[model samples]
Target chain A: MTEGVVVVGLNHRTAPVEARERLAVPPDGLEDAVRAVLALEGVREAVVVATCNRVELYAAGAEAESLAGELRRHMHARGGSGVTLYEHRGEAAVQHAFRVCASLDSLVVGEPQILGQVKEAVAAARSAGALRGRLGRVMARAFQTAKRVRTETGIAEGQVSVASVAVDLARGIFGDLMGRKVLVVGAGKMALGAARTLARAGASLLIANRSFDRAEALAREYGATAHPLTDLGMLLQHVDVAVCSTGASGYLLTRHDVATVMKARRGRGLFLIDIAVPRNVEPAAGDLDSVFLYNVDDLERAVAEGGRGRSVATIEAERVIAEELSAFRAEELAQRSAGPTIVALRRRFQEVAAAELERSLSGKLRHLPEGDRAAVEAMLDALTNKLLHAPTVALKTAAANPDGDDVMRAARSLFALDAEPADPRGEVTRMRVQGEMTAKAKAGNGR
Target chain B: MLVGFLAAAALLYLIATVLMLTYLVGVASTLPSRRAATVSLGAAMVAHVTHDILRWVTLGRGPFAGIHEGLSTLALLVAGVAFALRLLGRRLETLGVFVAPLTLLMLLASQGVDAQPAAPLSGALLGVHVGSTILGTAAFTVAFALAAAYLVQEREVRQKRLRGMFQRLPPLEVLDVASFRSIALGLPALTLGLVTGLSAGLQEVGRGIPIVSWRHYLALGVWAVFAAVLALRLLAGWRGHRAAIGTIVGYASAVMVLVGYFVRGARL
Candidate 1:
């Protein structure tokens, strides 16, 4: 039977936010919980990746099915009852690990936060001494895949967040915003956020609202100038950029006002960002020479476009993940298949050496010296290592390939290792031979 | 050697034209491939330069003296400048596709014309006129490339709703600024060139070519169009699609003057 790693848990898809919150492990409790998972019968290794959107326990064991049920029970006892658990073994586990790290499986698709979270989880597991061998390899592969996905895909094309989208449009018009004027036509949360984004980009800020007092108070936070709505026309002629998000029912700046401002500014380019629900800048104002207008809908369209671009990257990432996992699974299976034969071969060699030593020392060497006997034993040990070196290397190479099991069976039959499955000393020989063959297969396939 | 070089340059010109068409139709993905196409044109340019240099060395006179050699040398200069810009990371690769074909056409037309050099001019004023006009033409060649990129980008954004193309191309605002930047630089150069040409004509007195000849008139018209574009951009903030189209028109008229000279030289 092939030994494998399995992960089971509920994410945003299988569980609602309330259920996930109840199941969420505090960062401090993660290590202790992972230890508890290792305590389960047949669990060789374990790690818990817990986030706001997902709670998954990844475990490796000879008896994966039993370990999975135990993990599910532990999660339920921790108050995550009735949550769906998807089981992935071997290659499936590897691919799932990569997908999680890449953010292809993220709720926001291409948002870059999840990879760091996964890295933290892996680090915590390593420090706890719970990560070893297969689990460590899987985690490393996941990190690599995530990096490749970012480099190869246009997933991160446009700004998805509101503040960033505003900044993007602003930069498009102004090129470099340093020393440029940006007028904020409202003092609401979004306007404040947009103001912060613009100010950070080195644009001088002007806040205009119907309630001048609130606008003044908000403007003071970023050291910006404040103006009442009546002065917006005058402000428009001076500012290079404007962002309007007033909860106005109708247009605050009409075509006539924009035309007059354009004439006054002598046709210097103006960028208008309208974030209000009912729309603040009149659509006709866009027709003015040197005027560029973008409403909420345009920003939303850009976000959607960014999302689509990320999806294309996601497809490419999934293909890479699948290929990597398949290679990993094949290597694991090959090594596992060669285990018994390697042990048998080593045991047989030791038996022959021991018999020869007993015969030689009983009378002929016994009459000589104890030092002489010890020297002969040392010589025998060296001879055994030298004789076994090539086969051992070959077996290990075979064990690491996709078809490693076939190589292992051939090695076992050729060496007559199938005759003895028990006896620890004999089993060592069998497993050693099998391990070497598996390793050899892996090496050959790699070429 | 001259004939072999001319043939290779013509072949490269044809390849660049095909590649540019493929790129404009959205069949190609990377800008570097278009840039590679220009490298081939650059190889062709090396050959064109060699041909002109060989003629000058063998005949023991400046290649710019005859209408045949003058037009050919100008074409070689244009291609050389275009290749230099491509090396400097200017995306004027597509411009070579348009320019190399025009250059080759001029060179081929020159072969059929009178090979004799023009009667030597009397003063340094004529040299200044010729030098400035060539420099102005080179500047306009770059302007034409920027205008072409703008037009292609505009069409792709409008017709395909292609976010990839939209993002890949510089922003519309950036393109408009670049176009103005080119024209602003080119206008003064052309003005100096035109003024020097008029001065040269005055120095020659009755022996001077007519200012109202088709070649001179086309050059004047091209200068006027560029002047108008610069005024509109500065005074009215004319930009985007309209500005791009204006640059294309202005540059096309300038190219017409070069073609006019070629045809007239052939008949003579």
Candidate 2:
């Protein structure tokens, strides 16, 4: 059988988010999307991971080059011609899967959510019957590799995002947010995201936006309280964590205002996360005792620190992925070698056993006692098993080693089972040619 | 033969420690690395048990006769308990990196203590005192390991660098709960140990040797630290980094009590 895995699509690195969004399928539509990709010619299996930042389609088939083209056409038909696509076949495809699952290829490397997103995509494809054969196994192995990369490497360590870093700093101040109050100074998207993160960490949310309607609406969504922007100082005294994001040109809270708030709070540590562009919270406020003020620059520094940590982990994860890829390739080759040959060998043996039984039953065995004929059939079954057991074991053992293809080819030809399975020599030659072509293309693209 | 067994067990523990550290460093793949370390530890445990059995049968005495034997047994119990925790799906196997090296040290420390044949004592109080204290110490070792992991994980979160070794560790809440649970389990054992030890000391006092000693005071110190830790945790909602640090301090005091015995050259 022809076998290969290929991934062809665009991500945030290759295409803009708008292009990804155009191609993006929601969770509910993922199954239909996977089925759509599977419907493309020459594609045996397909899974589409469509997140906000990326849209990737991974397909496995006997002919990778054609399948990649078909996938490109399918994506273009769905997402428009403007979407820039990248293609990875064979070992590269498997590596891409591992990296994607491990979150190394994410918009923000080491982010944890990509693994879950990939798993969800695979699940959707499986439910739709779009994932089958070696592709499913490959994806499953990818998940395991992803999990390994996560635990073994610091790839997923630290809070890389601005909002999450704010939440993390807040957590450092208060070990657990069980009954801690969090105040949102503005009801903008950044503030909303920060509030949601704090809320998820079990902090009580209170929204105070200049626009009362927006504050009330956002607060109602989170089942939180809404206060007027005029009462920000009073709210700060009551809350442990405060997130400020607004469109104001000047600093929202001066150092004096924060110092006053700290005095009223009676030495309770106040964490202020300022995510505004023009700087919402005063910089000098961070110097106050019991006040932990982190503006956009500070959050970026935290993010950069996390990025450095992940980079160190990424080197280790890359090494692990390389190891996994080699092992996976060997296993894939072994399975590909043994699969059709095993089936054909079993069929040939069964056929011979049945013919012998039929001939004996119709002639000499027909005259024997019923017990004797039954005994003969049982003997034949045992004989077949005994005859095949050694070769079956040997074939499987050879498949686990480097000389698997040679042994598989020898067994196929010796047993006259060459017609069913693909010629090993021919497959190897094709793979080698494809590999060389890919290398040339890469070298050319380097220019 | 017993020495051979001890050396082999120590070597196996060293190998397991190396494997665990490799896994902790994130260079090794997750599943195979953990499996290798766990198998090595299991083999080491088997070797350890064999050594203990041979020492007991050959010497015609209980396992806790000398500091040499007692330290070996203490390491075995600590490792066995940590292995059991691993089996319970606690995701605490990474702690083997700490536990294995410490266990090896404990086994090596046994070499320094003279292995004189212990006289057969004719009292149940002695057995209760020694056995309960050893078991309590094992429980504390496990708790200390968990507390150490909890603090490391807490630091990673507080610092905002989340990959590699940090990712391999159990979550903060899980480690916190496990640390407290180990302490909870240990406290009762320790109390029983202290009660039995005091009783045994009274019996000894009647025979002319003083009941109170430096070890006795150090034991009280261990108990006091744990009591304060547990009380603060239960009543005042003391959980997280501070609680973990307290657990470490408490375990340190417990270790110091053992050191007190070692320094005084006492064998009981």
Write down the lDDT of every candidate, Cα atoms only.
0.70, 0.75
RMSD of 2: 23.3
> What class would a CAPRI assessor give candidate 2's docking?
incorrect
Stretches off by above 4 angstroms in model 2 are A1-185, A194-213, A222-447, B27-31, B60-70, B85-91, B109-123, B235-237, B259-268
DockQ of each: 0.11, 0.04
Each prediction's number of clashing residue pairs: 45, 9
With candidate 2 superimposed using the best TM-score fit, by how many Å does residue B33's alpha carbon deviate from the native? 3.5
- Model 1 iRMS: 3.9
Report how far residue A67 has shifted in candidate 1, in Å. Answer: 48
TM-score of chain B of each: 0.81, 0.87
Q: Where does candidate 1 stray beyond 4 Å?
A: A1-159, A169-172, A191-195, A307-447, B20-26, B31-35, B61-63, B88-123, B148-162, B171-174, B199-212, B232-245, B262-268
Name the lDDT value of residue A394 in candidate 1: 78
**Highest DockQ scorer:** 1
User: Which prediction has the highest lDDT against the true structure?
Assistant: 2
Q: What tens digits encode model 1's per-residue C-alpha lDDT throughout A6-80?
A: 888877666654566567666677888788888877778788897656889898876657877887788788755
Candidate 1 lDDT (Cα, whole model)?
0.70
